[model samples]
Target: MRVRLASTDDSPAVAEIYAPYVQTTVISFETTPPDAGQMAERIAATMPAHPWLLAEEAGTVLGYAYAHPFASRAAYAWSAETSVYVRPDRHRRGVGRSLYEVLLRLLAAQGYREAFAGVTLPNAASVALHEGMGFAAVGTYRRVGFKHGSWHDVGWWQRGLGGQGAPAAVRTVTDLEPSELARLLALPGERR
Candidate 1:
């Protein structure tokens, strides 16, 4: 597999990949899956501020991962909330890992100090993925969201990104050098 930056044109594939989770599972609380147009808008809005990476092989997108500011407050600028979604058929194939490896590196390079991920309770696959990626258990929000006829808990995980020190201003994805971004996506961890 190979990891690369995600573009607006990849929205249809992204929407397709996320649809199952929305329609059939409580993994995502969204009741209605966004179509290609809405997905494109999401990419356009978030990519300007954070990295959105896609993992593919032989021109087929296997998965994608991305990050956005953890919160709008100034103090939260150095922290990001992250998410990843894979083609259901691509599970256990390292596609999610590849996408995350690139996404985390890009976030750190852009000055993020931490990354956070939230998994719906009882999702062993997602918990395993987050732990395997070096995130530690923080705390769980009990009965946080009501969806699919029940209230579901969400477990949050955290991983430090940049070095310990006062963080400089975070840079947007558009500010990153193309060569640097390309180099990060080529990391060994991003290669299957």
Candidate 2:
């Protein structure tokens, strides 16, 4: 198996892994699954902010992971929210862990100070993955998200990227202008 940054070609496979979760489960709150083109655009737009990764085995995509803005305000620039999904058949084979390991390295390299993982309630595998990746369970909000005809809770987990103090030459993600961000978010290949 191999772990690497995803490209336009990986979207369809990623979407395949994501479809069932979006359609039948509350693992993801998105009600509609994005088409291949839009998923590719999403992957492209995250180039600067995060790294979208795929775990592959013999040319088959087993899982994917990525990070995105935790909040848009300047004060929240150093933080990012992470998302990871694995093909149901590939679960327990370490795909999610590999993807997240790569993601953390990429986020730190991009100068992010903190990373967040929000797991919708009852996702034990996801919660375990985050805890195993050195994330701490900050808390859970009750009834914050409603899906599947029931109230759902969101679990928050956090991890620090760098050492004790903030690094020098800080260029927060919010430092960029709206147009510049739009350009990044609108990049051709990956825009979910």
Candidate 3:
């Protein structure tokens, strides 16, 4: 599969890949599946500050990953919360891994200092993926989210992006030239 930056036009496919997780599982807390238009708006709003990436094979999107502000406070600007979703049929095929590797690299290139991921409890696959990518489990919020008539715990993991010492000015994805972004995404080898 090839990994590339996501465009607003990919929203419909992304939304379709995400709908099952929202409708049939506690992986996402969103009660209703977002439509393509909503996904397009989200892609537009997030692209300026963060990277949204997709993994595709034969022109079909297999999975996607992205990062967003970890918190609204200015002090939290160097950190981001991340999420990834793959088409159900594409599970265990490295689609999620490929997407995340590219996404994290782009985030690091854009000056993000840390990346965080939250996995709903009991999701061994997701937990393994994050840990395999070098994230350490930081903590868990017990029974924090209610879904499907039950409560679910969420485990948070963090990975440092090598940013340290005095803080540098963080650059948005929009600030990078197209060539630079493409180079970052095309880096070879799996992260782990």
RMSD to the hidden true structure, all candidates: 1.8, 7.6, 2.5
Q: How far is candidate 2 from the true structure (C-alpha RMSD, Å)?
A: 7.6
Check candidate 3 and list the clashing pairs: none
lDDT of each: 0.88, 0.79, 0.89
Q: How much lDDT does candidate 2 score?
A: 0.79
Candidate 2: clashing residue pairs, number: 11
TM per candidate: 0.95, 0.84, 0.95
In model 2, which range of ten residues has the least summed lDDT? Answer: 183-192
Query: Residue by residue across 111-187, what tens digits does model 3's lDDT show?
Result: 89999999999999999999989899999999999999999999999999887787788898878888887777774
lDDT of 1: 0.88
lDDT of 1 by residue, 1-192 (tens): 778788999999889999999999999999999999999999998886887788888989888898977899889989999999998888998888877888888888888999999999999988998999999999999999999899999999999995788878888877888777678779585432
Q: Which of the predicted structures, 2 or 3, would earn the higher lDDT when compared with the native?
A: 3
The per-candidate count of clashes, in order, stands at: 0, 11, 0
Query: What TM-score number comes out for model 2?
Result: 0.84
The runs of at least 3 residues in candidate 1 whose Cα sits more than 4 Å from the true structure, single-residue gaps closed, are 189-192
The candidate scoring highest on lDDT is 3
